[model samples]
Target chain A: EAGVVQSPRYKIIEKKQPVAFWCNPISGHNTLYWYLQNLGQGPELLIRYENEEAVDDSQLPKDRFSAERLKGVDSTLKIQPAELGDSAVYLCASSFSGGDGYTFGSGTRLTVV
Target chain B: GESVGLHLPTLSVQEGDNSIINCAYSNSASDYFIWYKQESGKGPQFIIDIRSNMDKRQGQRVTVLLNKTVKHLSLQIAATQPGDSAVYFCAERKGGSYIPTFGRGTSLIVHP
Candidate 1:
């Protein structure tokens, strides 16, 4: 079975530029999540999606960060006018409903200069 | 504002020895716990998991012990190898919730 897939494994952009990351979860998984990880720290939840509906997104920055899960299979996380602090690894994970563990992607490492 | 935290930021062990990593969680309502191993430039990979109802769960050479009395969780890696060198994180999830909160990771360095 294939693991979670993410594109543009490394991204470098200037501050104030827009950047987007994409994720394709494992087949048949019903739950998807987006997380941000800073250097030397664990991942922090940004948003979670149960199918097409976002059940929890309180941690997402509404001013510039936005996410969408279309058809509940693929997801996209965007940060508009990115800041230097936004430089971190963006990780995506998916799991089966009521499953024991989650499958994670390799993640996109974003570098904002 | 419950949180999960690790006791050690880094641990160095000789290869073939056993290693223990510890975590403490503030949320008593969290019923599900997971241990994830993350390598450089990669996302966290699930190593083992234990529920509140379980005190211990074992998989491969990894074991997870949950002590609800003190809200402590631990991961034990036996016969550690160089491949086991990575950052280990403990995550907790409340009952009836799928979202998990991750703690700062413990970096394990297995010296050969």
Candidate 2:
């Protein structure tokens, strides 16, 4: 079975520029999540989708960040007018349902200059 | 709000020895706990999980112990190997919550 997939394994953007990351979840998985991991820290949930509907997104920065799972099979995370502190590894994960073990993508390492 | 935190930032152990990683959580409502192992350049992979109702759960070579009274969690790896070197994180999910809160993480270094 294929694991969760993410594009642009690495991204570098200047401060104030815009950047986007994509994620493709595993087939038949009903839950998808976006997380941010800074250096020497564990992954923190940015948003969660339950079959195309965002169930939780309190941690996302509303001013410059947004995410969508239009079809529920894939999702996108965007950060506009990025800041240096936004540099981190963005991880995408999928699970069968709530509270299930997650299968994570390799992640996109974002570096804001 | 639930908060998961690791007791140590780093641990060094000799190969073939056992290693123990510890975590502390703040929410008494949290019922589900999980351990994840993340290698360099990769995301976290599930290692083992234990529910609040259960004190211990064992996987292939790993064991997770949870103490709800003190909100302490631990992962024990038997006969640790070089391949076991990685960052380990403990996460918790409350009874009615779907999103899990993660700890800061502990880096395990196994030296041969």
Candidate 3:
């Protein structure tokens, strides 16, 4: 079985441009998460979806960041007017349930100049 | 007010030796904890997890320990190898939340 899959392994954009990332979670997984990881820092939860419903998004920057999981199997994270500090790896993970360990994708490295 | 942080920013250990990574959490309501290993240019992979009900949980060459009293978590790797070099993060999940909040991470460098 394949693990979680993410698109555009890398992306580079100038500041103030828009950027988006796609993620496909593991089969049969009911929970999906989007995280942002900066250099020398750990991955931080941006949002979490449980079968199409975003259960947690408190950490997400609502002003510039938005995410959606329409079908519950795939998710997209978008950043409008991206800033230099937005340069980081966007990781997507999925798990069987809320408490289980997650299976992560390779992640999309975003470089904003 | 809830946060998880590592005791060290990096750990350097010789091959064949054991490595212990420590974390301190501030949330007592966190009922679940997990350890994730992230290689360069990749996302984090779960190594092991321990619930508040349990003190320790073991996996292949890895172990996770939780101390609710002190709100601490630790990951121990036996016979560490160069392949074990990576950033390790500890995550804590509250009872009602679906996602776990991650720590700052600790870089583990295994020497040959």
Question: Each candidate: what lDDT?
Answer: 0.93, 0.92, 0.90
Instruction: Please report the TM-score between candidate 1 and the true structure.
Output: 0.96
Candidate 1 residue lDDT tens string, A5-112? 998899999999999999999999988999999987889989989899998899999899999997999999999989999999999999987754488899999999
Instruction: Return the top candidate by lDDT.
Output: 1
Candidate 2 lDDT over residue span A26-99, tens digit each:
89898999999999888888999999999889999989999999988999999998999999999999998865
DockQ-based CAPRI category assigned to the predicted complex of candidate 3: medium
TM-score of chain B of each: 0.98, 0.97, 0.97
Off by over 4 Å in 1: A99-101
In candidate 2, the residue pairs with backbone N, CA or C atoms under 3 Å apart (3 or more residues apart, or in different chains) clash, namely: none
Q: Tell the DockQ for candidate 3.
A: 0.71
C-alpha DockQ of every model: 0.78, 0.83, 0.71
Candidate 3: segments with Cα more than 4 A from true spot: A97-101
Models sorted by TM-score, best on top? 2, 1, 3
- Each candidate structure's count of clashing pairs: 0, 0, 0
Alpha carbon lDDT of residue A21, candidate 1? Answer: 98
Writing each residue's lDDT as its tens digit, candidate 3 over B31-91 gives: 8888989999888887888889999999999988888888889999999999999999998
Residue pairs with colliding backbones in model 1 are none
